[model samples]
Target: KRVGEDLNRHVTTDGSKAEWDAQDVGLMNQVNFDESTMPIPLCSCTGVPRQCYKWGNGGWQSSCCTTTLSLYPLPQMPNKRHARMGGRKMSGSVFTRLLSRLAADGHDLSIPLDLKNYWAKHGTNRYITIK
Candidate 1:
């Protein structure tokens, strides 16, 4: 009865209850599911996907990881001194020198390649110091 009352209260552009009722029916029909798709087979033990099997006190047990439908908010980390230093601008020569030092310490050369490409295109007028 409450649902019917709420539906009747929903006003449309035609300002008629009959038009709103028809529109609601049309919208609901458009959201109908396809008959061709097959449903996923659920694990008999946990009712979720069976990822692994483990031996318990009796015999082999089916282990499954269940997913939550609720949304969980993550806590933010405090900004550190290194993050603040990352915003400092440096000359192209100084940037190249730092890259060379990193390379000598057995670091990956992809960082230098990316910096070289950026320096060639932008000419390093405002290059941020990459930590």
Candidate 2:
């Protein structure tokens, strides 16, 4: 019931409870068959060594590495009005340089490529493509 409660209460905007309730039906549209599991990927920072894995079978697994949370938040996206309001195109060199800097700073870059081999070895999200 905790997960359900989290889904119901924590998943939506603060003042739109009724709207959330009506739309929450869509959340169940993608229910899975066999359970899937993901260990929180290892921290890519050179000094930190481990992280915890939340398993599908209802257990927490731990390791020595630490994780670096992205400056960008998950689920929530940048506002559309704010997205390119700075007068920059998506593929501009400034954006490319920023991404490269972020990658060098240890941001994971693999999410776009959809590669599993890199993930299998280092865990999820330690390398990302800046280009």
Maximum-lDDT candidate: 2
| lDDT of candidate 2 over 10-64, digit per residue (tens) | 5667535355235332323322212233223332223343443333343222222
lDDT of 1 at 6: 66
Query: Considering every candidate listed, which one attains the maximal TM-score?
Result: 1
The whole-model lDDT of each prediction reads 0.28, 0.30
* Tens-place lDDT digits, model 1, residues 27-123: 2223211124412112332332332221222112112211211111111223543221111122433334434444455755442122211121211
Model 2 TM-score, all chains together:
0.18
lDDT of model 1 at position 41: 16
Q: How accurate is candidate 2 locally (lDDT)?
A: 0.30
* Model 2 ranges with Cα > 4 A deviation: 1-88, 112-131
